[model samples]
Target: MKKRLIGALLALTFCVPATAGDITPRLSPTPEQAQAAYLSAMFLSRYHYTVKPLDDALSEQIFERYLKALDPEHLFLTQADIDAFADTRKQLDDAILQGRLSIPFALFLRYEERTAERLGYARSLLAQNFDFSQNEHYPLDRSKAAWLKDDAEARDLWRKRVKNDWLRLRLAGKDAAAIRETLDKRYTRLLANSQKSKSDDVFQTFMNAYAGAIEPHTSYLGRGSAESFDIAMRLSLVGIGAVLQERDEYITIRELSPGGPAIRSGKLAVGDRIVAVGQGDGAPLTDVVGTRVEEVVKLIRGTKDTPVVLDILPADAGPDGRHTLITLIRDKIRMEEQAAKKSVLPAGDGRRIGVITLPTFYEDFEGRRRGDKDYRSASRDVARLIDELKQDKVDGLILDLRNNGGGSLREAVDLTGLFIDTGPVVQQRRADGKINVESDSKAGAAWDGPMAVMINRGSASASEILAAALQDHGRALIVGEPSFGKGTVQSLINLDQVARSDTPKLGELKVTVAQFFRVNGGTTQLKGVTPDIRFPSAFEGDEFGETRFDNALPWRQIDPATYRPANEIRAILPELTSRHATRANQDKAFANLREDVAELIKLKEKRNLSLQEAERKREKDSREARLRTRAEADGTAGPGDDGLQSSERSLSAELAAEKAFKARKDVLLEETARIVGDEVSLLAGSKRLAVGN
Candidate 1:
């Protein structure tokens, strides 16, 4: 998970009595908070998915995990810092019980100081003109690198870092002055943002670390964050449809929701920072740097159809560069956006099959509580789409769950009902090892015709459940990369609910209370659901999924549930594999995807980056060429709209959006269509053979 940036008005300071720095620190959780931690621990040990003792060994593990969490890249904390905190490494468990969080707080103060010092060093390097002509290599990903012995080693690293930063910008057509200016502002803002961490921020960070030590998905939400989580669970809000989060002092777009204005407009993207916002024509874009993202949201949000302009710093661009302004007309949950929508893909055999792209398994809990019959959810929308597609006489259907991080679990169960005719879909194993089967209670299948379920690394949780159900039942052909293997179910336990008195609001604990299993008794925990037909994953050899997590629950299984599979596709997998191979070799898009994946694999191995100006430029040019080729092949709007992580220039939101939407289409869907067509033919052939026999 990306580091959740906790920031607000830097001006508002939280007072705490302490001795860490000139600014005293709030070094302990409140009496209620301490109680909350204990209550949470008791609940976790008693009711979590796989309970474990809060023993000395667990405490030691938690301590190390917390330290690593503080500095995953080994950038801020040094060896000395690690040694200094080693004493408390085995003490966090005891401290949590006592409501004393002084150790984590102290460590954070040191991290803040060290971070500020690094930024200071970075700032100082801006004065010295960089000599990129020197032959040197700077490490880009320092996750595996060792912590520095001292500040001198750290300063040397920072100097190279500054040079690398300058070299990259210069290669990207930025002048020396411009590069310096960008780094100056970036470092300055970064430092200022570091200082703005309040007690809530510290508590949230430490508690998250504490909770994460138990399991990756489990977390303790502070009062503010708990409220935010509530607001986010709602499906509709009038805005650009871009989820923004505070990332390194800049309000950056986190994810673009399918069918949202930002997604439709195409200008905004994940990591693009909103530097400013404007309302109406000719209105000046007001700078939003250092402002609370909530405040920024208020500024950008308005009544439906109102034009909002955003001055954005393209994701990888320098801060000093001129920003691109994107104009969007916000709407209140536009029917097209967030709703399950369908498109038709025609195969070479002249058969048209419908593809339903489900971005998330979203459910309107509030509307449902209010008894609104038309409350939106993934199942209902998909059911309606299925009905529409049936009217079109489509050959088959594809559930496109690519990039679909699962939402509501109930939605997944209900959606599975639309396919399977009254059978068990998934089984939940609780902490006590009791199994509860969630089955499709409905009598008949919504559409019994041939179907395909498309998935990728981003398809997770509820998405996994749906895809697995369809696959396990042989109701749908599973296509694409391995799904994000999240097998655990998180249940929210309000700490305040545990308390009887009216006091300061204790936060909530999102704990992994149950593990999900397929009806076949196979657990999808660490080794997510592997598709029957595989695509060359760009994620190959990378540590990005469940298996990469620290102390993740291991793969396990129990007695198979008592339910029969609809059809065992395993028998035809070899033939399917051979056919897929033949098709991929003949297809240009698959060839490109293979080459890109190979390049990615090679790039992953090449960690050290050349700092020589010529080498850097050559590398940049090569990358840009690849991106341009991909853009041309994908027929996207521009180089930026292609799947490249970095781009040369800023793009207008509208243009960017157009190309982005275009870029979303690729060989994967086309192949799935062909596969679906093959299934249709196979079904027809089987019927004829049966009749003849």
Candidate 2:
């Protein structure tokens, strides 16, 4: 198998010839560091999917990506400043090979000055008053916006930015003094964070830029981030088990740990902006905006069983969205907590339906390697639940993979084997240009009653594998939005291990080592698996997928493996599609969802966001009113309102979570159960024998 992996050989790529008198860096790498870089370059060039040349083109891209990473919002560096680094850009290849970090350090020093200047301007706005009535706009999502021509243009942008910040807070029920205080505190904290950037941090940032240009998954992990990554993997740290990253002045929750307190709470969600954090009930939720992530993280961390209240602004809400306070008990991640959870859904004819929400494709590799008799994995847990559900005589099953970012490749194969009698589960393409068919040679099906798999944009990697395999085998109907397209495999290589370094730590590199393909030879790279019954996606844009990266590995195909369809889903897709549309039209929640999705799309398309307080307030009010009306009809409260018909107490995190997981009102799940019911009907309607009969 190892021999099948092909390495691409580049004639001119071994090393760049070192020249004398290179600009000395402020924080230079040692000879050992230089060797690590050379080794990494060679490893990536040979193994990376693109095998892009190490010439001037890639060098230019590395510089561009580096700059973008540091100042993505283009608030700091100007167009003129970028142009000044053009010569430095071309010399990156040589710099990287020769262990010269001077160019990147020079750029970073300029970035530091730029940040100080921007922060000073922001702080200056606190002393001045602005008219809330002015019809102004702010370019909120300026990721693609051109850099400022000069400092004057930047100041103009920053002025509106200041007003926009003021308006958002004001709309959120703060007064002028409070707003100024918040902005002042935020800027001061930000300035401090800027000052704290170490040379290692800058080096990691620069290296990641180079790595990311190779592929989206490839990244350089600094010592701090690497340590954090290790902690997350071990699941030992106690806190709200949510992975977060800084995005445009907010710490956004990326993925929730499957069995963590966060996921079980079900109140916290991906893309939720954590604007504030506080201790157990009664504490004021202090705003965390513009604060260093570590400071925010420290505030959230606490002892086990202790509650933390997070004031979050959900991603889908308006810019001045209602802050939803969610409380969660801090606890270590337990396997049982995160394992496949089962609940019964109602079928139309007084029958029960089984729904298994698998948060991730988990596996205890160490236990398995030690040959433990009772090892935990997604397949094992799911197989047990299937037995219990079958005992309950469920008419059908729905496997919920929503927000499942995926894990454990072995589990994806093992889990897929539970459904099919015998077939290939997935195909893996290595650097050698050969495809490895990972197969299931077993001969018996598991539960096999009418089944449906539910997924969304967050479903990725192993999640995509299982969904694509089931879909390919005609075993289960898939539901929800297109899955997150992250098919490539990442291998973490510690750079310090690459070249022995005792004095200076070299951190680690997460390199995209391989690409995953469906058993049918289709790659789930950028174009994730299309659900059989499509649902209106909450993530209306491409911001959440592998395709969002500028240099993501392109989707490719291989020869179809020898296989046959196990069932006839294609024949019933028309019937399912028709029924789904009809139900969506009649279902009020579904209708509301569709409208929400449309609004989100419009928001995504807008190049500029309104800074005018009245306009912003109008949009926010309209959205809230619509939601409140819907909530009233359902006999529940909406945003900023308690769930009870009448109550003195505010919403607790536990109650809020229970309110959310009320399955009947979960339009997505409701429709999923209905779809599974349809699949059950299809099974009954067909002449073919029911699976596992």
Candidate 3:
């Protein structure tokens, strides 16, 4: 296989692009980057689950994906600029294979030029008064829109964009003078960030373009990112404890580390955008709208106990929304903080349902390797938690895996063993078509009574493996929405291992090496583990999760693994579903949650918003009113009487938001407990009937 792979790569003709215009690059690719590029290409081509060739077809894909990666919203780079690089459209494969990065670097130089010009134009518009009374609409999502035809078209879009930016602040209650200063500083900072782009940035972007063109999960981890990944693995992140991603011009929160300040404060959430950041109290806010992700990370990261204040644009709030200031002290996220926690909810009739919230399938690999008797692992932690719950005399259990973005695979398998005797839990199929089964080798069950596993769109990888095993074994009822649907397994290839002694330190290649499946013959790749009883979800259709990625692998099935089913939950699932529906419809919190989710879905589907101030105000007011009503219904304090329209930071308002946030989170869990209550009742009735028979 190795010989054949090398032969295919060598068969491709390597070529180079001519020097691009008189424009001098602020940063140029080094020999190290070239070597990294070649190494990434070779590894991705050989080990990636999908075996597409490195030819013209993939080259064109790389070109388009690279353009998208640079300007995802099509806000910059005119048609003329795109046309200038037409010659290199089908040559990226050859260039990347040979470690020649002239074309990509040249393209990046042009992108940098365009970015500076655009920001300059945007800043120039700050002096002019926008006619907010005019009935114009700004396209909120331009990801699928066509690129600008020329410089004239680009300026026109910028005019509207600048107008929209101005109006957002105005509606949020900023004076014209303050708005002008804020926007000017924002654009200036953006231009400065553009000029600060380095050679490594260009290489990382281009390599990711090549990687994402093949698969969504696979990518090249540059030196900086590689170091961050290592730090996270060591469980010693210091800062706000938020995982951020660069989306369009904003650094958006992607995930929050469990037990971290972000989650503890309950102010930040997935999808909130950090617009500006400050140090301590009353420090000057540094606008980070268009800053590099790593740069923003540096700004956010500091010594423990130092406070960082983030000016946040809440996710539900559109680009034209109010900003809230959230202050959090920097602290290290330790292993003990991320350990599993348990709680018990009364289910009437003196019965209790135990809930175990496992943030990730974590394990102390170093401790285990050193043969430490007290090595921390998800299975071990959960086993101890189960013992505590058993001592509490719980009648049922709920394994809450919502927002748990997966972790140790060994722990997932071992955790499965706790509820089932030795059996195959999951299967993996490699690129070479070799299938391997991972099974639970232990005997006996831990609290094998009525149980359910709760999952959501954030649950993935190891989480999917465990949920699938439980569902397939008929050991637990899968509840809530479908999981993240990441069935492909990625293995990191350290490029430094293949480098010569004198070669510059290299980065790593995270490639999709295999696809995993459930034991019941079906792969979870695209179609994640579907719940037997689904709850009302904010996400609909293919709007989120793995289905959102066009390059994601397709779902398929293989031969089922040999295993014995424990208890048939399917037999009583329909009855459980009916009971859940009846209770959820009657419950006030559940009804409010359904309404909130429906509103969120609408917001997600909205692609355009009125540029008119009056119209926008009416819309914003109506939305905030609903939020206030939802909070009132939940018996929690909300954004005061004026709502979240105020941009000023208020201790009272912050407290209200925290209360509302916690209440919203509990809505789902409370309903899940009710469903589990139904399970306990049904199972009890079934056994009683059996005894009578």
Candidate 4:
């Protein structure tokens, strides 16, 4: 197998563009090159798993899919070019099937030339228009239509755009020489960073193209990204915990950390685009469109307690999107924010339910690396929390993994152990088809009380593993929406380890070399774990599930592992479902949640418009005029009617009443605590059996 793999890699090197710099240059493939590379790599990899040797027909199909992904609209390719490429398709297919890596250097050179030409064109535009206000303004979705049609047209548009951009920057009082220097420096850094990546650039590129062909959510994490993954799992960063990705010219929000300032503010949404950022009030907002994610991160992150304001253009806003200035005070991330937070909820009929909200299975990597005696790990923390909850004498436990994207696999297994006697928590099936059963590897159950695990479309990976294990073993009742169905396991292989020398600077590559299977022989691939009692979640749209993703692995079953049911949890599920339904229907908070989701859906569906369509927009905007007018009026108004008839009136009687109410609420934390305590007592029914007792 190793020999075959090495043979394949050698063949791949021949197909890949050769390194041309003192340091091995990791280059981006042109549209044509990307299509060829993607086809060859995907076919080879899939064939390695499915067939004894690569087949010619499969290679042709792979080529077709690759081309379709790269140029689906067929706008970029002319009839002659398509015909010419089609004529050579057979030979290319044979080369890939035969594992003949030696593609002509001329082809690679062409790819290099194309890439250089594109970069040079982009640089020319930057040279001409630094400010970029007037080249051509089109909606993000329409950008490809406008610019990526033909080389000549694209070049012309870029030239004009760049000229206008530079003019604007000059107008803004930036020195041209300094700007040029900065650009050069940034480009150098980017190239250097790319070179430092340890993973095979060709393979990483193939994965990226494969992911792009599938869906936005499916991504291949290169070696450099493994560090990022570690950071994400740890939930610790110097900057604001918002992940952004370039979608067209704008940087779109990819994910929001559970306890990040952005989530706390409740203003920034996943689809919002960041246009500009300011260091402080009245500071010039720097346009960051088309900037690298790292540069954007640098701009957004600041020293603790320093405020950085972002001018966001929400996806739902019109073409010239409305600007929302969000101010966040930066600080070092707290690991606890990403851990499970425990609370006692009144589950009526004298039952105090322990609610453990697992935001994400987090681990403090930096602290652990530093050998801190009290370094935090998710499983340990959760285990302690479960013990505490048990001591509180809670009758039932609700492990809420809603919106959790998963984390450390070890932690997941350990967390699952807390519910049942030691058993296999998950099955890891490697590329070689060897299945490793990962068991609890720990002592007795921490809290074996009636358990309900809540999941949603966002509950993925390790989260899915835990939920599926608990449900399969009858240790818990799965509730809420279906899990995210990301059952693959990615192993972060340090490129440095593979390198010939220790000081070699190649980064890392996190490849999905294995797929996870559940103890019951079920794989949570495209078919996620279905809840025992499904509940409505905010993200229930048709487009949001794993099933919507193209190329997602199909769900299958394996042999179920033997395990004893912790308790008769299913018998109580029906009653629990009924009770939850009744309570949810009557709960004001739940109603509010539904309303919020509806409103958010409405907001996200809005689109951009041309200046000519502004009038029509205004007509539509009139219906919302009352709300806008009320807000505008509120900005200038004092407290209430003071009968002074002045432009700005003093605080009024009604205003005083509102302020008094706010003050009372502010001082009523103790009262609120007392109320919660009473509710807890009433729910527990004087059990005196555990901790709260």
Best by lDDT: 3
| TM per candidate | 0.81, 0.78, 0.80, 0.56
* Per-residue accuracy of model 4 over 387-418 as CA lDDT, tens digit each: 89888998777787878888888788878887
Error of 2 at 327 (Å): 25
Which lDDT tens digits does candidate 3 get at residues 1-693? 355644454433132123222334476777677767776776677667897778899999999999999999999998899999999999998787666678898999899989989999999888888888988878888988999899998998899988887877887787989889878866776687678787788889999999999999898888888867655444466787887876656898877888889999999998799999999889999999878888899899889999999999998898999999999999976645567899999877777999999988877666789998976678888999999999999989999999888877788899988877578989999988899999876666676778889999989999999999889888888999999899988777666655532542568888888888899989777788899998889874376789889889988899999886755477888899998888887888777777778888887778887888888888888977877776676654244333123223233454466566766558777777877888888788543110000
- Which runs in model 2 stand beyond 4 Å of their true positions? 1-35, 223-338, 372-376, 500-504, 538-542, 635-637, 640-665, 685-693
Better of 1 and 3 by TM-score: 1
Q: Count backbone clashes in candidate 1.
A: 6
Worst 10 residues of 2 by lDDT: 641-650
Cα lDDT of candidate 3 equals: 0.81
Q: Rank the candidates by lDDT, best first.
A: 3, 2, 1, 4
The digit string of per-residue lDDT tens for model 1 on 626-693 reads 77877777653233222112222233453466667766757789898888787777676442110000
Task: Give the CA lDDT, 0 to 100, for residue 662 in model 4.
Answer: 49
Worst 10 residues of 4 by lDDT: 641-650
* lDDT value, residue 96 of candidate 3: 73
- Global lDDT of each candidate: 0.76, 0.77, 0.81, 0.58
lDDT by residue (1-693, candidate 2, tens digit) is 132331232232235334322344344444444555565676676666668767788899999899999999888899999988888878887777676767887888889989999999999989999997777789868778889889999999999988877777777787878778878877776787787676667778888888888887888776667766654443246787887766556787866887888889878887788998999899888898876677788788768899999989997876798889898999965534566899998968776789999987777655678998976678888999999998888988899999899888888998988888788889989878878888887778786668899999999989999999889888889999998888898777666554444643657778787898987888999999989888987573278887787667788988877778766777888998998899899987787788878988888788897877778878888877887887777744445522112111222443465466553357788788988888788778564322321
